[model samples]
Target: MAAGMLAGQVALVTGTGGGLGQAIALALANAGARAAITEMPDRLPLAEQTAAQMRAAGGEALALPLDVTDLTTIQAAVDGAAEAFGGRIDVLVNNAGINVRQPAFDVTEDAWDSVLAVNLKGLFFTAQRVGRRMRDQRPAGGCIINVASIMGLIGYRDRAAYCASKGGVVNLSRALAFEWAAHDIRVNALCPTFVRTPLTAPLLDDPVAGGDILRRTPLGRLATPEDVAAAALYLASPGARMVTGQALTVDGGWLAV
Candidate 1:
C-alpha cells in the first residue's frame, strides 16, 4: 500500500531479458529502487533494453551479463552490481529458470540435468553469493524472493523435470530462510500458476491442454507478468519484513482443489 517504499533500495534481479524477470525488474524500478538487470550473455542486449526502459521511466538501472549456472560469472556480476550501485544490494529476485517438459519415462538425462542446472542449482548458488553479501554488508538485512511455480507445490503432467527442479527451490527457500535468520536475510518464494509467458506458451497453445488448465483453475485465467511482479514487489518491500521461509502462491486458485 505504501508507494515509493523502496526509495533508497537496490535490487538485483536475474534473467531480466524478458517475461516475468523483465516485468519484475520494471516493477522494482517503478517502486523506487535502483535495479541491476542480469541475463545470459546472449541476452545482454535484451537486459539492456529493460534497463533503458527503466531509465526512461525515471529509475536507475544497470544491465549485466550472467550465466546462473556458472559460479564465476555469478560472482563477478554480483560484485559488479554492488560496485555500480553503492556497495549494497538490498533485494535479490532469483527469477532465472528453465523447463523441459517430458513424461518421466520419456525424459532424457540431458534434459533433466539442464533443467535442474538452471532452475535449482543455479538459483541456489546465485542466492548463496548474494546472501553472503547481504549478511556481511547491509546493516539492515535484505530480502530474497525466489520465483518458483505452482508446479513446484503440485505435480503436473509432462513436467517431471520442471516440477522436480521447482520442488527443490520450494524447500531450498525454507532452508535458506532458517539458516539466514540469524543474519537477518529473509528468504521466500513466489509460486505462480500458469502465467502467460514464453515459458508456458507451448502448453498454453495446445487448445485442449490450455482449456483444461483454465477449467481446473478457479479463477479461469492465466496470471500476467504484472501479477507476479506485484507479488515480488510486496515480498521485497518493508511490508513483508516479518514474512520469510514461505511460498506466497500467486495462483488463480489452481491449487485450491
Candidate 2:
C-alpha cells in the first residue's frame, strides 16, 4: 500500500449520509485515512453509500447510525469507530446542522429550539464526547473540524436561526481548541458559503434568494460540496497539524466584498 499523510489514521465524519459530509468522508479515505460515517437511522442513505465507496477505494470505512444531539449515542459511535478500525479515531468532523430560513419575526420558539438543539447543542456535545475519548487514547490526540457557514461571519435575511447556529459553531471551535490544546487535540471550524447540497438545493430553486446569492458572491457562483470537502481534508490531515481554532472560510469571496 502507498503511504499518505493520514496513513493508518481513523476518521469519523458525522452527517455523512450524503452531500458535503459524504464528500469529506470520501476525500479523507482517498488521502489514506480509514473513514467512518455517522447519521440518523432512516434519515440518510448517503452514509452507507459513502462508506461503501470508501471500501471499494480500498479504505476502511465504518457506517454507524447516530444522532449528534444524543450524547450517549454519539459517544458510543465515536468509540465504535476506533474499535471497528482497530485503532484510534484520529479525526472527527462535525458536519451536522440545520439551516432555518424564515423571517426573524416569524421564527417560532419551536423553530429556534429545534435548530439550536441539533445545530448548536448537538455539535458541542459531539465534540466534547469524542474529544475527551481521543484525549485519553494512546496517541493522545486528534483533530476536530466543525462545519460552520459564511452566515457565521456575516448576516442574511430570513436566516436568523442558521446564522446563530453557525456563529456558535465558529466560536465553539476556538473555545474547544483552547481547552483541548493540553490534550494534543486540534479544533478548527470550516465556514463555507452557500454550497450546492440537499440542504441548499431548495434555495437554488427559489427565484429570488438563489439569484441574490450568486450576485453577492465575488466568485459569481455557489460553492460545491467538493469545495468544502477539500477544506475538511486539509484540516483533518497532518498538513493542518499546526492549525487550530480557525473558522477557515471557503465561500468564494462571499465575505471579501
C-alpha root-mean-square deviation, each candidate: 0.8, 1.7
Off by over 4 Å in 1: none
C-alpha TM-scores of all predictions = 0.98, 0.96
TM-score of 1: 0.98
Q: What is residue 249's positional error in candidate 1, in angstroms?
A: 0.6
**Candidate 2 lDDT over residue span 170-201, tens digit each:** 99999999999999999999999888788889
Number of backbone collisions per candidate: 0, 2
lDDT of residue 85 for candidate 1:
90
Q: What tens-digit string does per-residue lDDT give for candidate 1 at 33-98? A: 999999999989999999999999989999999999899999999999999999999999999999
Best by TM-score: 1
Those runs of model 2 whose alpha carbons end farther than 4 Å from true positions after fitting are 1-3
Model 2 clashes, total count: 2
Distance from true location, Cα of 140 in model 2, Å:
0.9
**Position 176, candidate 1: lDDT:** 100
Global lDDT scores for all candidate models = 0.93, 0.87
In terms of lDDT, the poorest run of 10 residues in model 2 is 1-10
